[model samples]
Target chain A: EAGVTQFPSHSVIEKGQTVTLRCDPISGHDNLYWYRRVMGKEIKFLLHFVKESKQDESGMPNNRFLAERTGGTYSTLKVQPAELEDSGVYFCASSQVRIVSTEAFFGQGTRLTVV
Target chain B: TQLLEQSPQFLSIQEGENLTVYCNSSSVFSSLQWYRQEPGEGPVLLVTVVTGGEVKKLKRLTFQFGDARKDSSLHITAAQTGDTGLYLCAGALTGSARQLTFGSGTQLTVLP
Candidate 1:
């Protein structure tokens, strides 16, 4: 089966611009997650979607960032008025369930650069 | 906030050498997972250890979960150039959301 896939492998935008990253999860997977890694930093969770509903979004950095998984198949993360700090690699992952120890499959990631 | 601390921040070793990386935390987790990420790629799950004191081996790679469930270690035997990448450790806490808390990561470079 094909693994999770992300769109626009690399994106470069000017400061204050808007950017949207997309992710397509594996077939029959119900758990989708968004994460990002800033320069020289660890990957951080942004939010999680279980089916079409968001299960957790506490890791969202600010109001400028928004994520949605409509119909529970794919997900999109949008950053409005993107700042320099928003430049980083955005990753998407999916799993079959939220069990205690299930493995999550990750996409290659979308690298965003704000100049 | 739950935090997973990984040590050695970076490692550069010659091929056929052995190395070990550690992940520690003060908080107990119900399960922990290790991942390997190459440049321009997302992290790929390596293994998940759910039980305390559990040891799982994948070829030359061995993973051990702490008896207290607060730490874990990864040992790579006779490392090769293929093992060069970033290793990350993540934890899933009990009663919390299913999201994972990831460690800073250890960047490994194996010289050929």
Candidate 2:
């Protein structure tokens, strides 16, 4: 089976511009998660989705960031009027179960550079 | 503040050497996992320790969980160049198992 896949392996945009990153999880996986790692920081959780409904979004940085998973399939993360601090790598992950110890497969990640 | 603290944020050693990295936290976790990530790629799960004081070994790598479930360690024996990468430790807190708390990560360099 294919692992989680993320689009636009790298992205570069000007400050205040918009960018959308996409993620395609493994087939039949119901749990999807988003994470980001800024320069010299840990990879922080952003949000999670079980099917098309968001399970948790407490980790989302601010209002300028939005995420959606339609039809309980793929997911997208959009950042509007992006800031310099938003430059970092965004990662998507998936797992078949919701248990704490379940194995989660991760995507290569999208490197975003907000100039 | 970092919930999980990983010692020696960066490590460099010659091939055939042995090294051990540590991950510590004050909060208790139901489970803790270690992952290895290469440049431009996401982290890959190396091992997960659930039971306190449990120890698991894979090839030349050994993983140990603290007796309190609040810490973990990874020891690499006779390291190889292929072992070079970023090592990250993440945990699922007792109640909040849905989200994982990650450490800052240790960048390991094994020179051949």
Candidate 3:
């Protein structure tokens, strides 16, 4: 099966611009997650989706960032009025099951640079 | 607050040498997972340790979980150049919403 796939491996935009990153999870996967790393920081969780419903979004940074999974399939993360601090690598991952034993497959990640 | 902290942010060693990396936390977790990520790619799961005091070995790599489920370690014996990458430790907390908290990561360089 194909691994998690993300589009626009790298993105460069001016500050205050809006950017949307897309992720296509593995077929039949029920769990989807978004994470990001800025500078030397750890990979921080952003949000999770179980099908089209959001499972948890406590990790979301602020109101400028939004994520959605439609039709219980692919997901998208949009950053409106992006700021300089929002420039980082955004990773999308998915797992076959929700349990601990299932390994999450991550995409190559979209490197966003807000200039 | 960061739930997990890894020591020795970076390490550079010659090939065939042995090295050990640590992951520690004050909060208890249901499980901990280790991942290796190379440049331009996302992290790949190396191993997962669930039970406290559990020790699992994958070839020359050994993983150990603390007796309190608050810490873990990864020991790479006879490290090779191929083992060079960023090592990350993530903790899965207990409860219905299982989100993973990751450490800052250790970047290892194995010189040939």
* lDDT by residue (tens digit), candidate 3, B1-112: 7779898799999999999999999988889999999999988889988899999999999999999999999999999999999999988876645568899999999999
Interface RMSD of every predicted model, in angstroms: 1.4, 1.6, 1.7
lDDT of 3 by residue, A3-71 (tens): 999988999999999999999999998889999999978999999899999999998999999999999
In model 2, residue pairs whose N, Cα or C atoms come closer than 3 Å (at least 3 residues apart or on different chains), thus clashing, are none
Would you list the C-alpha lDDT of every candidate in the order shown? 0.92, 0.93, 0.91
What digit string (tens of lDDT, one per residue) describes model 1 on residues A4-111? 999989999999999999999999999999999899888888998999999999999999999999988999999999999999999999998645545788999999
How many steric clashes does model 3 contain? 0
Assess every candidate by TM-score.
0.96, 0.97, 0.96
For model 1, residues B1-112, the per-residue Cα lDDT tens digits are: 5388899899999999999999999999989999999988889999999999999999999999999999999999999999999999998886777788899999999999
Which ten-residue region of model 3 chain B has the weakest summed lDDT? B91-100
The DockQ of each candidate is: 0.74, 0.69, 0.66
Give the Å shift of residue A91 in candidate 1. Answer: 0.7
Q: In angstroms, how far off is B91's CA in candidate 3?
A: 0.9
Q: What is the DockQ of candidate 1?
A: 0.74
Higher DockQ: candidate 1 or 2? 1
TM-score of chain B of each: 0.97, 0.98, 0.96
Q: Per DockQ, what order, best first? A: 1, 2, 3
- Candidate 2: segments with Cα more than 4 A from true spot: A98-102
lDDT for B23 in candidate 3 is 98
